[model samples]
Target chain A: MYTESNEKKLDEIISHYPVKRSAILPALYIAQDEHGHVTDDDIRYLAKRLDMRVNEVEEVVTFYSMYSRKPIGKYKLQVCRTLSCMLQGAEQITEHISHKLGCEIGGTTPDGKFTLQEVECLGYCDLAPCLQVNFDYHEKISTESVDQLIDSLK
Target chain B: MTKVLTSRFDLKGEACDIDVYLKTGGYQALAKSLKELKPEQVLDEVKKSALRGRGGAGFPTGMKWSFVPKESKRPKYVVCNADESEPGTGKDRDLMRYDPHQLIEGMVIAAYCLNAKDNYIYIRGEYWYIKEILEKAIAQAYERGYLGKNVLGSGFECNLYVHPGAGAYICGEETALLESLEGKRGHPRLKPPFPAVVGLYGGPTVVNNVETLAAVPWIIINGGEAYKALGTEKSGGTKMFTVSGHVARPGNYEVPMGYPLMKLINEDCGGIPGGRKLKAVIPGGSSVPIITAEESEKVNMDYESVGTVGSMLGSGGVIVMDETTDIFETTRNVTHFYKHESCGWCTPCREGTRWLYKVFERMHRYEGRPGDVELLDDLADKILGKSFCPLGDAAAMPVQSAIKKFREDFDRRIKHTLVQINKAAD
Candidate 1:
């Protein structure tokens, strides 16, 4: 169940496409924003609203790396672990954050405040060793800066 | 020096604003095309420009446009591949973030040529900020009559919207992008009925990269010949290279096609930092073959020249690695990327990438078998061109080339494992 404002937002996005199903990705974003991660109930509601099978919505949600099927931490610390980032010492950055958070890569903090993930190229290689806290990018970051970032977030 | 694609980058944050873009001669090409040039003439200019796709493949842009059926009954679509997820590629991100209007103008010109009214820019979800910037610019374009039911008082109508992908690299492939846009899994479709013929809601479609589309307005405004004259006869026009890793100046540099690879690394990028010798370079993105510094001496940043040195000018993502870098670790890292990104659509790619990654991981952990190097080479060969899309080839090329050029690195790992095993047996 989406808020009235969110429902209005979904309606507006759906109007942009000729087919209602085309808006599923954008609609999921709204639902995720409303309910943290995509819950099973959210998928069912989206399937019914968009006139699609539940499996269809589930597959799309599961296929993409960004969408979360279950609940995640408030702060998703996604470090870029691809070629360029690695060349600039992304491994050390990931390690530093992992140490600071007291969790391994792909693990969430005990308090559910932060989750660390090793993401593929974020297209910010020019600013290598970059990471994203939620949607905000922290580029060309040093281990010290990463430490500061965690402290600030905490 | 002639920044055709990134001429407005100097405007900094203000480049995204329509007023600044207007002052700096932004949408004049769109105006020129809509008023003076016919659809065929517009297309002819692009053809004469000799521009190739900037999104890795380097296919001729004009030829791709010509593939769409001219007299199609269904609504044609012009989809901009703004999914700049190639490992080292970030030029498109800059193009869209800095000069959103340039991309919009080019898209409108393309839509006019294709007789398509509805266009979508499928950007990666990670670029949510850039999406907002693009959306704001699109709003500005709509307000100024550059888009909507009529454009700049011309009868031709166009509507442009930004569509965000939910984080899948395979979606960067044209067909996979179309599939994702249709609210499905980001699995690539079979070729033959290419996007030009049957694409985007089962209509004729033309998908061009952000950098490729951003160049269209300039090609139209300054006659195609003028644009072509800027670079090599075959390559044509300037390209933006996102030079990263080891370089003192790791930033986006817009240089003419066929610019010397060494010059970019030395003069433009300030060479490898801390006096480190350049060990290897992934001239393209992670997908292209790696070239040693010795081989890179004669290489130029063009499709043909880079090809001669056994690499591609893919997405113009020049990833430099210094002598201190270990080739084995780097290859393992890259292999893991393919393993994670593989869509599992094709059996060879789906299974091959996972197996290759597992072998690389074992080798990295010093558990490599004696024939692991040859096995990786064999696996890469099997996946090279045996998949539904280029993703498999992308996954395979880097691994294959790394083994060819840096065989010693793999051999050294296997030797270390062998020695350890012998000592244990003793």
Candidate 2:
């Protein structure tokens, strides 16, 4: 999905680290930034450029959960449900969102508007029961807040 | 001259020999522990100090040490998690490279108290230079009888080895670290049989961070009350803040717990580089949420206090961001990291991370529909707390927190990108 320009910037970043493996993390970031997910072709491109094996790149991409092997919905919703958030009632919010969006964690909605996912620690323990919609965070979440928030979506 | 937030860094050309570390008042704690205080006494002193783990999670240190079984048949073990893979943090390399003996002495003391026979420093693969330095220290330690059979002739024999990780960030996690040390995939195992009962070849193992164990030698040397006097009530002892990013004098700044973040940045770190106005900061390492400039001002570099401002004292990595930077792009960088690093052992993490990254990409491309922000918030809420490991949670935290605190910026970036696209078309 990247243009030739995006590919060039990725190549430049790959050159910073001595070991090709060290460049993998930054390379994957750049590739994913260009393409929605890192495909086999992208891994091969990076592996070849970094002088690393394609399997190595593929192994790393598969090892990390963030690499999307398939196309995902337009919007991704990550909800925090760790000890801190759970103690703050993350379960209630989880059910409300799933029911309203008609999707479960890792399940894209039928309409393709959103895909719901549960996460561990969003690190904002202060604002428990928080969810990150795209790159934004809506904190102190509840059923009503989840509905109002979800309703605002196109 | 770099500030002495790190004992080893302070020893620049200070000497790698045991004599050098000892001259700088090394092993004084062990001397105190052996000569004056008993083993349980040393442990009690740490308990009273209220020192917590320096690893990402601020689990109480003394509390973790006490987890070692009082009665166990097999040999107890102390495994140091020196695999510092958290990006934007690099203080561990400084310590290992300079003050090798300091950590060596700390491990010996820890082994003595826990009644463990062997210790392992699980250094990351990238740190060959550090590995060599530590190996030299190990050889010197053995030659001087600081290690090996009957160490210091107290009938306490402990052997220390340096183990290198192939390359896995999850190995930084304790259970996963144990798995990697055992030469297995670094996926987290089911808890309930926590590391205390069965860990590292299925024995009573106490795994600690390099910085965590390094503090032990000093703790044993000083009375618990003496260490307690240095920091605030809940968080005691000095911590290494690896300040980077916009900070001018960025490096390791050693400050006692509860040190004000503002003062540490301004007075110690010499404020931001280029005198750029402070924007936000990742108080801990990558796993902790980002705090705004105002919130960072109210923060203290401790476990409990930093939490009050919606961030953590994670690994004591202070990453400062100036106002000119974009928060969305910053978090997008972080999300991209988690997505690339998540070891798809669990469903929530594997699928969630992929989706989150995709959405960010769309937004970056000026393809976000109206109400895209709400969709992102929804996705972050869904993926957090449901994963098998902290990786998933960490991936979601910065994205959510950055967006929550700096939604306007993301909106602006999204709007600005779209405007440019339309103008180019015209």
lDDT of 2 by residue, B1-426 (tens): 212226556558465888887778776766666667677887898788777888878788788888889899766788898988675566676677778887888788888888888778888754555777898989988998888898777777788878766446787899988765654457888886878777777788888888878777767766567776788888887888777666666666678888899998899888876768999888887778889999987888888899898778888877777877777776776677677667678988889889988988988887676677777777888888989988888888888898899998777545445577688679
Task: Please give the range of 10 consecutive residues that has the lowest summed lDDT in model 2 chain B.
Answer: B1-10
Winning model by TM-score: 1
Candidates' lDDT values, in order? 0.92, 0.74
- Which window of 10 residues has the lowest lDDT sum in candidate 1 chain B? B412-421
Can you list each candidate's DockQ? 0.92, 0.02
Cα displacement (Å) at residue B269, model 1: 0.5
Reference-based lDDT, residue A37, model 1: 95
The complex in candidate 1 yields a DockQ of: 0.92
Give the poorly placed runs of model 1, Cα more than 4 Å off. Answer: B415-426
* Candidate 1 lDDT, B195-291, residue by residue in tens: 9999999999999999999999999989899989999978999999999989999999999999999999999999988898999999988999999
Q: True-contact fraction for model 2? A: 0.00
User: Candidate 2 — what's its lDDT?
Assistant: 0.74
User: Candidate 2's residue-wise lDDT over A84-153, tens digit each?
Assistant: 3453577678888888877887799877789888764443333456787765667678888888888888
- Report RMSD (Å) for each prediction in the order shown: 1.9, 15.9
